[model samples]
Target: MSYKTILVHLDTSVRAHPRLETALQLAKRFDAYLIGLYAVFEPNARAFNVMAGSAGYYEVQAAMRRERAGALERLFHAELTRAGVSGEWLAPGEPADRAVPHHARCADLVVAGQDDPGDPESYIGESFREHLIMSAGRPVLLMPYTGFFATVGQVPMIAWDGGREAARAVHDALPLLKAAGRASIVTVDTKADDAGPRIASADIAACIARHGVEVEMVSSVSDAQASAGDMLLSRASDLGADLVVMGGYGHTRLRELVLGGATRTFLESMTVPVLMSH
Candidate 1:
């Protein structure tokens, strides 16, 4: 039930170090294999060359990309050695949105940083986080860009919706739940059919109890003016939760990975580490 392999996305952005350090700490905690993945996109000048053909421009651009890749590779190895953690590095000549998800398929969990909306060059695009969570077929642990997380899974909040995606997230988070000291399972905006949610919450609590986790069930009715995500976050803050476990996008159609309301809210205003699956 433990994560045996962890894959982390790396880039040349300002927040990359925090993301990598967080991954390193998790790897050490779980004693798992850590893999650092970087994607470098080489600019294509074919469209420009359609009117003005120049092979030299493409060559120079390719050289610059290669140089940047080398620098990033060196940094990765240096950090890996200094940390003394078991890991490997992969730098593929593809877009991050593609390469990261490709490698993420085989990992037990993927670690990524929250996209900084203010930094246009923030290694990964803001939307790519949702894309990876939806496409990777694995659980993703996202670190907040504005905060530092030295450890995780001590106190967790589970956002329960009773959908397939939410169920998947709960199951995927079993390893962390099994090790957590305390946890809370909360449902937001439940239907008038309270019996079903009560039964479901009790069942989930029982399941986690078997894993040796102290679990509590919480039910909150959302205000008409506030979104479900906002309520969940507020509750999590009240509980002083360090980790959030929830589904990625259960209510809305992905349509090329466009996020739903709750999912988008988590991406935009996450204060703690989030573990999401779809």
Candidate 2:
């Protein structure tokens, strides 16, 4: 019902500070224990040795990585101290794509950064966010790569489609909705075939209201030129929403994961923080 433990992924990117700040704020708000997991991409030393014909380069890279990790650990601890929140730092020497999801499962919520194509330092791999959302088995809160969000969950908009994934997302975000005191459930490009007559936005609104959250239902019909993701973002901006809660839609095909069109759009162009669950 409440977030008791929050796991945040930290990397050697400029945006790491903002991500940590967001996690710290949530930790303080929920009175939860915070875990800072330091995971970054490390090139294969063996491959480097084969190319350079020497181990010296590998040693140098390892040493530099250690130094950066140590600095990040110190920063994380200091910030936690200043925030008066209890937390611990972890550096599991493993691929972030695997390690993050392994650690994230134990926490109630996971905080991660959106992939920045321009920042190679933070790149874990392709479809990292989609993989995390699918494998974490918990809600993931992703911070935008280009924004400084001092406040989250103040005014939230829920992207609803009445599917299983959307249902899971809405419930996973219940704590934030209750804390925010108000939320808007926006259904974009609603079609009778998509959401059956048995399920309606009003019904979900009533359910959320029972939890003491003031819920508003907003329905919009999107034009052929506009995508559902675009409609959702425009509505959020118009409502001055700081957070968006929605389902991360994706599926595996031929050992590759393909995110839904709307999900892909949000991951690539989110202006505000987004909380997604699969």
lDDT of each: 0.80, 0.89
Instruction: Give the candidate number with the greatest TM-score.
Output: 2
- Per-residue lDDT over 50-168 for candidate 2, one digit per residue giving the tens place of the 0 to 100 score: 77556887788678878888899999999999999999999888999999999999999999999988898679776788899999999999999997788999999999877777889
lDDT by residue for model 1 over 1-278, one digit each (tens)?
89889998877667877888888777877888999998643445675477565677777766766776678778778877877788899987677888999999999999988878775446465368888888899999988888777678888999987766778888888888877756899875545453253336677778778888898888763788888888888998899899999889733355555566788899889999999999
Off by over 4 Å in 1: 40-43, 47-68, 123-126, 190-199, 250-258
lDDT for predicted candidate 1 compared with the true structure: 0.80
Superposing all C-alpha atoms, what RMSD in Å does each candidate have to the true structure?
A: 3.4, 1.8
Q: Could you tell me how far off, in angstroms, the CA of residue 169 lies in candidate 1 after the best superposition?
A: 1.1
Task: Locate the minimum summed-lDDT window of 10 residues in model 2.
Answer: 190-199
Per-model TM-score versus the true fold? 0.86, 0.95
